[model samples]
Target: MTITSVIDPAIIQAYRETHFCVEGDAPLTLRIGEKNETLSALHKASGATSSAFVTAWNPYSRRCDDETNADLQKKLIDELTTRSLCFVNGVGRHPASDWAEPSLLVLRISLEAAKELGNRYEQNAIVWCGADAVPELVLLR
Candidate 1:
């Protein structure tokens, strides 16, 4: 059975338009369903067959203050740190929107774990990729 997302179409569109960027060392940008050579190389170099792009901002697109978002994101980092997961700091930004959020490229994370993290943070969706390095949107709403 297929589950329909309750998330708004506009929000979903914004997600599609936004750039999922991984920062540090070699910066990389991920576009939904697009194969990224740099990302594939990163996966091969790190021996990580999968990666999840997640953020803890604007739960369900309800726009929270910067401070609240920052604190929530810090908590997310703490959770990843506790798990000893390898993650890199990143940000998601849309070309037409000024709003941007702190994000992370979590290496070697399972799809289930990524879904759990997205739900735990009350996000509408996340970007996940496998060894193919093609990002796919996972809606949680």
Candidate 2:
């Protein structure tokens, strides 16, 4: 298994400086594919809890192998609607590698935000937060 680590200190620093705000409601661009709608889709899907490029795979795609991106996306949607947890996808993957690129996706929300999603979804959702001001995952959560 390979463990891939990706950290763009510049991006993080920029986000910190700007308080993680996007301009004029413009969607954040992700690095995996050129498509710009992931951020906006995730934002609307996740109720704007947070936005970031995450590492997820679509099983039907040759790149994903076993998991369909649709499945992954659905899982995230459920997580967001039920629990209001944010979904971030961006990291790239290589064959035989364990980790994907664009590793860190932030979910910044008040406890009230969490509560607003209600209990059923909240009960089904869980988030793994990072300790070092950033977090990494082996799979695309």
Candidate 3:
């Protein structure tokens, strides 16, 4: 098993407009030796509409200015939802509403579906924004 840790409040704040100052560490586990098969299965499960795995980085962070942050946030959201499955590690739940955002809603629903499908990886906890920095999910990880 490989455990990857990524914490980037800058991108979190820039990419995610719903929630700024992300704080928390979500422990995720990727089972070893099945990455290829797992990805293929997920791709098939996603149907033809979904895009294959794609990697994008959002440079936007909460600390960024208004205009720049907005651009980055859009890019982040676009990248986050483009893939068949997103494996995010650090980042707390968006405030105001749990399913307020589309990406978040998709993530929540995907997590639930994965649970039903017996996905081995599950989010373990949610830490507040002030508690810790958030991590971005990347393919190279």
- Which one wins on TM-score? 1
Model 2, residue 62: displacement in angstroms?
7.0
Sequence-dependent TM-score of model 3: 0.23
Candidates 1 and 3 compared: the better one by TM-score is 1
lDDT of each: 0.93, 0.35, 0.29
lDDT tens digits by residue: candidate 1, 1-141 = 765789888888889888998998999999998999999999998999999999998888898998999999999999999999999999999988787888999999999999999999999999999989999998888
Query: Among these predicted structures, which one has the highest lDDT?
Result: 1
TM-score of each: 0.96, 0.29, 0.23
**Candidate 2 lDDT trough over 10 residues, lowest sum:** 132-141
Question: How well is each residue in 1-141 modelled by candidate 3, as lDDT tens digits?
Answer: 754445345433423333322112433312222233333333344332222111111221114455654464455546455745443322323454552211221232232343322211122211111101122232211
Q: In lDDT terms, how accurate is model 1?
A: 0.93
TM-score of 2: 0.29
* For every candidate, C-alpha RMSD to the true structure in Å: 1.4, 11.8, 14.1
Model 1 misplacement above 4 A: 1-3
For residue 44, model 2's alpha carbon misses the true position, in angstroms, by: 17
Candidate 2 per-residue lDDT, tens place, 1-141, comes to 643324344432322222111222344533222334544454555455343322234321225534455565556455664764543433333433353422224355444443333232222111222222222121211
For candidate 2, the lDDT comes to 0.35
